[model samples]
Target: MVKSGQVSRQAGNNLASVMSRSVAKDVYTAIIEFVTNSYDADALIVKVQYNSIDDTLIIEDDGTGMDQEGIRNFYRIGDSEKIRNPFTAKGRRKIGKFGIGTTLLEYLAERYVMETWKDGKKITVREKFEGMGKGKGPEAVIEDDPGHISGTKITCRGTRFSKTGLDISALKKVLEWQVPCLPDFTVYVNRKPVSKRNLAASCIEYAFDEVIKDLGNVSGSIFYNKNDSEPLKATGIFIYVFGRSVGNPQGFYHLLPPSTVNRVVGMISADGLDDEISFDRGGFKQDSVKYHAVKKFISGVLESIIQDITYSKQKEPPRDKTDEIKEGIAIALKSAESELNKSLVNADGNINKNHPYRLELLLDEEIPWISRIDPKNNVIYINAYNPQLVVYSSKTNPTSALNVVFLTLAINALAEDQVGANNGNSDLFKRFAQTRMEVAKRLFSNFTPIGHYLKQQQGNDEQKAIAVSDVRLNPYRLYSIEDAAKLFGRDIDAVTRLYMAGTLRSCVKRRGIDRFRQEDILSCMSKIEGYIEIGSVSDILFPSDHESEGAAKHVLVNKIIDSRGNKPEYLKNVGSIAPLYFVKANNVEEFKRWYNGVE
Candidate 1:
């Protein structure tokens, strides 16, 4: 026989018991969710303070303060009212769904407190986990404080953090990497603002804005003119990384390659018509986002962008627009796929093979209307700029998307191959790596510069540079059957038959011949494309172990003769390429004679 209030207390205990378990997973995830909510609220300033020693965390945001009803709707568990409205003053679509982020703090800590205000009214909610549970301690307080500012302050006490100590460096790195775009926002640890190296400027901040303005497509503009004395205005893309604003993206184009470090192949942003790109778990799977919604959102922005691009090409007639539109569509699709893949991919480089996605052209309009790539993670980021979808890819090619997917797969496969390539190394794996790097380089070169820079900064500078170089090489450009046959010392029919039968090796033999063919033996011809191959010729020249003298005398001579000194700058810029080429070609004698100035 329990008293009436005791019976109610029993039910409350059960609810509190379950609530405790609810916040059990990753603590950082809770922090991320709260920060995301702040971003969605158009909060320009979000301060996060945490002390591992005390196991305490504090998050403050200068976003639109929530009143009593708003707090009730937002703070109350299982509330969906905020998401249902679907519109913020900042034009950010909602991402929060369960309204359980607040409880998560308490789950991680012994006590959680939230103080917020809206329309001059302030409210506070405090929860404690001691007695309200089955055998636990006491009750928590949820209040409304009139003196609170027009913002929200979340404080956690007695928090159980995973790490032994506060990893301020690692935390700063993560935050900087995660929110590279929102430079105006700041993150501080122990009252000290974390510093990050700014990476690159957004393309939208570059000529893209000018392009947009020139095209007169000002439907939902996000870029604003800055008073900075810089010649270029800020494009809508966010290129800052680790609390530092990225340098001009254009400067990186020639210096970095996509496959190197963390490459910024391009910048993209969604137009105002879609949900903001932020980490949230509503309307998406756990720890993931809805792929279709994202795609539709991106497609709408792309369609609008294509309109601007088309208008830029005013000299072109409508008769030729079909092919042009197809080209643009292909570019957009590839970029979209790449961006989505990279965003959802994990550090382990594993991809869910069974990713759900679909794309459809909007009424033969040459622009895809509905595009969706379902993510397994429930986190969706609500971005401030919903239009002008910015997409990054290996270049704007249909194959780039496939490459991104396959590249992740290959990374996993290679990791497995490393265990089994005990028979020395996997020839197939090497070829695959080479091919993938080549493709990645090409993509990075044409797509944008950030990816290349990222890769370089991550220490694979040489490899990434090669990849960027290959972008312009058009390695896919091969001679016609007839031309190839001639170069292989065979007839067209024989070459075609051999190629079809996959027996080209039998048809074309290279035994003890320094040159693959007579054309290969000839002096360098003056062709613009030759410059690309010449630039990449180093891979074929000099040995990895050759001394500088041996390299210069052997490789440099042949390149000069082969290139006919067509590009004099190569003499200074890539002298190594010249020397290496001659040495590897077994043209040492020819090189020596030329170098010695002998007839």
Candidate 2:
């Protein structure tokens, strides 16, 4: 029941020429091919050693060695039994289909020695090649090596390694990427073990598999580098046929964009792709329909995985220390309130029940002060005019603004407690005021109007730089009134009123411009009850007396006339010097209507 095919002598000679001409593209690739052969042989441990002194590379493995018939089959180029039966006797898929791997030794060295033992029999073979370009084959000799055990050892001499010898570190990385996940199996180079555990630790992996109608089972893992700065050197999806790696890492050009190439690495195994692979077993045949189908599927899967990663990152909460800050401030506020309440009492010796101490937080468009503690009313008011508070409150979680409120209340409570202890000593009060202002500046530095306003002057190099440096040193440093106005979104006159009220303590006057301390601004911010409209008398009305005494009265009367215009219904004499008009201050809606009709 045996059948055989024969080739002519000329054809055999031509085949030898083809084998001699074909060689591996690189030394590392040639080495990978030989190692992959050992894996197909069901090797448990593969040892590789390079001798720089002699330029020799030795690869040995503890696998099922070949018999005499197997040796003959190995020598037959392009006629491997693996092509007919794609799986080994152990049921493991084979990586080498063509017998070309055996001929790859010619590309690595000029001379080589191979020894193997099987079934109590041993064989030692030696080969010497003239040169690759000569089209001449290796001269071989066979002998018995009875001392050899049940394994295979290949020693390649006169290797074409670089002048400094092999780069063991780089070679180890290549092996780690090319080798599949083999349980209880390890590869050692120069007695050092190469491990995949480190690579796995630095990646986020996801497992995926899809069954295509003509492609059998397609399965693989996608890995994204957790740290982009230190990515794997050979990053891409490594394609495997059977249990061995075939071709260089692929899927870079097709799977993802160029920007993400360094951050992604993967491995895919498609057993049915064996038939569609090239003769050299390096890659799939481009014209094969099965190749395109598998590529398309892998591309789709990779795109989905990338989208999932992006979505997860977007949903992750931003890292911050605001929660810790808020908690500390809350504790401080409670302690300050408790200390201040002890000293605050009525004349009857009982704790003040009518004017109970409380903290009030408010947001007003017209408020000019940062904060105020009223001992008479026992109320602590904080202004929402602070730019820091506005920015923080607008966040998805308004913890930043809440922190400002707690801190401001604590500062005000402490100042009130200090004032009660001092009993109105001017010197002691000044010291207490100084201390309170310093504390407020430090606590609400980021929330201050001046702080936010100065940030907007980024175009002014000298001023912005000085402000930044001062803030870094002490957040409560004095700023000019104009800067404060810009920060509070108020006019200069309103800010000046705060300065005159003594709530805003002046630090120093420079070039006739007063520089108010940040702490003083916060203290005076609460003292501002209402805004006064200040201007010249003529500006307030169209017609007014030029004389000083009656100038104010005439301005007021003209204001009323201008407000009413020349409406005949409201005027008794249309063009007379004295006109009668009716007004209603109680009806706010009616007053607004008349005001709208005014000149």
Candidate 3:
């Protein structure tokens, strides 16, 4: 048992304990709090200095300084005059609200000295904190000081610095992002002024009002680097609330593709968001409905801008010859697919069956081949720009065009057989070249008589001379070893070896280069059957191969009959309608016998 003694009751506030508890989480927050307070006082110039060697931080501002009464009001916790009156004496908007700016100083250092002058009188105050925790109130001392400047100066000793110490560059960036458009306001780090350059000259502004409900007015500008100069250090659309930035400049989470992002930078301001700003002022209150509404509106507008830029880029003319060629190939392939499918049939006279081909064609001007067959994909890539194809198309009729398609299909079929085997044989390409040449020779021989007949029908010397000269004197009518290699889709060295081995003949020599005429090439090809063994029926057929030579001829005769669908009597004289190479028939029963026979 103990008797209760008379206790002296004392009522006091633990200012240090309160201030320590109010410590900011980061150095940047602590620094910005003081700078913002300066802005509230209508500061025109704010200077910050960090001395790593002495572990000290100092901030000096030329603003309306505090008097004795103002100093007492500033030391009050959680109560600020700015909260009652949100504007300054000079009619400028105020940033400080809860009188926590002094508390934030505890986060930067253990001790702080503040001095100010007002109405021709100067006063100084010093406060020291033990540590950042619940403890005794901070030790404070107040005194008069001889000072002439009419502003505020704060020095924080025993300051805490990050692992990299002071980053002046980062501080400058923060200042720029915070007060980029502030008029008559400037900040300096280590005596170097921080300023933001106006991009108005290179940018297009979009002024929008109340794009989203309760989001207030929205305005921004999209800027482009005309010379493709170095990319902006901070890219993306920066978001501002009132006049202060809410976060680091963002690229809208990198939504746009690099093509548009690299050329563009932007800034957006949303009015009335200051009320919804986060406590730390780092960003908006994410859960707030107004914040989400603002974000959604901004995102949609940025997406539209990106689409416009992308569409404009696409509208520009082709960048190079390669691009033009690619476009041409795409158009030609689409047209060819539409036309070729109407008449295309398989060796068994079935339409698009058993061989199911898909074609992919690309034009590569550097490829040393008039056309190449990528049999793995059943693609027949052609060089329509080839000198021979250009000349031939100019003078030929529809039948000649059909013959060219037939030759391409024949080569593709033969190549597909070899590619499907996957045997990895080096001589397979040579076999393919031999098959191409053999089929081309047969088609040319069958087509030549028709050309001569057409020439005779002209019955004019001028027309005859032009035709003869084109066949004889035109350089496009013949091929050098390199050109022949291109036409046959073989290596130049292999084709040259064929020339040396007496398997090919040169029609003439122009400029010391051996050139083979179309007629001479066809003659040489006719003799190749004796030198190279034909392994597949495709090696003989012009457009497609059958199970046997008889089957191929049957399909050709049937195709001819189908072409004359309007004339049913054409089948009565089958021999007259048949090509010269096909077996003649005097009656339908005889034709059926040949068509039905096994290999």
Candidate 4:
């Protein structure tokens, strides 16, 4: 005969005896777990104390505490009275659902002690860990308690964390986002009260109030912080089920543009999402309908908030491009003017008042060139209307790029004059190379933001440079342009650009062919080896452009050339030798900052 009987599911003794794997993830989680229990008890204030020096953690709260039976349920595995009673006696919605008990305190340390008082009764439980069967079960002792007030306190010694050292600031943020959004409830870390942090320095908020089709009422607020702070930035919106925080989605980074990533933070609470809450409570069940509803709803609103803020910024009044370009030109010229005036350009290889170096920025883009030089006049003509330059000026460091344009072209002009008079590249080691190198160094150091970084790195790099230069056995060594190009992993055009840009000087004439000394080329390579942050010639070579009335369609294609008027040597490999700017200065990003001075 077949027999029918009722069946029930149960967690094994060992399985239910431990805290949920999710709740025991870290000490912070443990703090959150305990704080949450306090909150569920209708505690208005919870204090969390962590003594890194002593490796101790203590959580104390004043609320309706547990009696002896409540203490028994606390140690019981897979059995939470919270599941049966949706609300506490005070009518506050319950936060704890999982009944996995005891292991969390052990996770904190090898030993645990918990105490509580309720209705003139006191119970204290102490648990010690040993090998499975050898471990002592939780020991509860009753004490005299006549005080009307009740509360709970959990204390642990020899805590499991020290490296993190219990960052109270981070814990403050966690308490704000991880716990329920309650105005009356407050959390304190190490006696310092946790408060809303960095939320008011240029902040905006978006609030929502609505009911999901099946997930019950959902309400919350999303905040945007303009402060550039690591601690202030929220990873994402925290999801709360009933009064318990479930997960942080981490969608804030991807939803907003890079400019606003991590600036957004929020919370979404649904009254009925118990089934959707993940086992660990770090997040939610991906396949659950209620979870999907919460996520989609939160993502949609968050994205809208980001778009609104981004759009407002775009709506601000924009400055005239021409005035901006002119201002950049003026600043760049002023920065290099004094040094350029002292440059070795006169007949005596020194300053010449009559022929002082000057930069002439012109909006005349009738010619397709970025720069032009007149030997008669000390003025260097920069086509402020160059189309490609206009594109670069819109970036962070237009003035720095412009300074490079003026200095490189000026050096090339000087090199053409002095080096042209001498037939041998060795003459540079004999005459102008040192002066030219010194002049290049001064001009770069004084003008570009990138130059400052190079100044810092030069000591380290220049020392190693001689070692690289030492690889050349002969002082009279000669390398054809193509040979030098191959050595530096560049193309013929790129090497030629460097030579004409005054970054590399030609050594001597062999069979009517121009050759460069390894030392000259080596120094240039060493300075730029790791400092190369430029790409196309247009990036640094050209940085000005102006629109001509009625000729908006006329786009000038930049073809950079030296003062001698020859095309820039094709750095077909390095993309037009633009990175061969004087001294191969520091990181370009820092240069941009120095040039812009955003602060």
Q: What is the lDDT for 389 in model 2?
A: 47
Model 4 CA deviation exceeding 4 Å by range: 1-13, 16-23, 162-164, 226-235, 319-599
Write model 2 residue lDDT over 1-599, tens digit each, in one string.
54588754544444543564464656777787778878877788889999888788999998778888878877877778776777766777777767876677776777788887777677677777764345334444455666666778899999866464688888888788777557656788998887763453335555556788888888877677756546666677888776666665754556676666877777788887888877655677889888888888878777776775675465344645443343233334344444445446433433455554544443344544455555444556554344434333323344334454556554554465455545665456446545655665577566533223223322311111112112211122335664555444444433543454344567765433466655655544333222222211112333333321212233244346645545433222211232222222133244435444563
Per-residue lDDT, model 1, residue 464, is 24
Lowest-scoring 10 consecutive residues by lDDT in candidate 1?
378-387
Judged by whole-model lDDT over C-alpha atoms, candidate 1 comes out at: 0.41
TM-score of each: 0.36, 0.50, 0.48, 0.50
C-alpha lDDT (0 to 100) for residue 131 of candidate 4? 41
- Compared with the true structure, all predictions reach lDDT values of 0.41, 0.58, 0.55, 0.59
* Stretches of candidate 1 exceeding 4 Å from the true structure: 1-24, 131-148, 194-599
- Evaluate residue 321 in candidate 4 and report its C-alpha lDDT on the 0 to 100 scale: 56
Cα lDDT of model 4 by residue, 153-247, tens digit: 99887766766577777787778767776766788888987864335423445666778998788887666775453345455676677756677
The model with the greater lDDT, 2 or 4, is 4
Relative to the unseen true structure, what is the C-alpha lDDT of residue 143 in candidate 2, on a scale of 0 to 100? Answer: 57
Q: What global local distance difference test value does model 3 have?
A: 0.55
Q: Write the residue-wise lDDT of candidate 3 on 1-599 in tens digits.
A: 64699767552455545554444656766787788888888888999998888888999999988887888778887678887888877787777665777777776777788988777777778777765454454344455554576799999998756445777787777677666357688888889888764442223333344456666677655454433444555556777754666765653757777666655566677866777876556677878898788778777766766654554355344455433333333334444543444335534342334443433322233333334544433345544323223213223333334345535644454444455345665356646555655565565543332222222222211111112121221222335564444343333333444564455677665433466766655554443312211111122223344311222333354454445434322132212223212121223344344333411
